[model samples]
Target: MAYKISEDCISCGACESECPNQAISEGSSTYVINPDKCTECVGAHDSSKCAEVCPVDACQPDPARKETKEALLARYKKLHP
Candidate 1:
């Protein structure tokens, strides 16, 4: 699933450069995650780098867009290819 930045985001920009797919960008108030480009780091890292680097723990999985690991990997492949 894609990760979403909550209201808790500090606008730190830490997660901006951490996204391998360049899925993250600054929004009107906080950094936003583009679900179409988000693969949850399935093919890039063992874990989500944005969640790891976020100081306020604003990055969290989007439960509304649930998907399996294989699905995420497939998306990652298409994106990097």
Candidate 2:
């Protein structure tokens, strides 16, 4: 599954630099994750780096955008390729 930033986000930008895939970007109000580029850090790290570093716990799995590990890996490949 891809990670998403919640309204709790303070826009501290702490999560932005933590995203290994560069999926997180500044939005009008908060940071937004590009689902097409998000792999939840699967291919790059053992866990989601954005969630790991977000102080407010704003980063969480997008319930509406679920995907299996296989699908995540495929997305990772597509982004890097």
Each candidate: RMSD: 0.6, 0.9
User: Which candidate number has the best lDDT?
Assistant: 1
lDDT of 1 at 75: 95
Evaluate all candidate structures by whole-model CA lDDT and list the values in order.
Answer: 0.95, 0.89
Q: Would you list the clashing residue pairs of candidate 1?
A: none
In candidate 2, what are the lDDT values of residues 1-81, reduced to their tens digit? 888899999999988887777898999999999998899898889989999899999999999998999999888888788
Provide the lDDT at 49 for model 1: 96
Worst window of 10 by summed lDDT in candidate 1: 1-10
- Per-residue lDDT of 64 in model 2: 92
Best by TM-score: 1
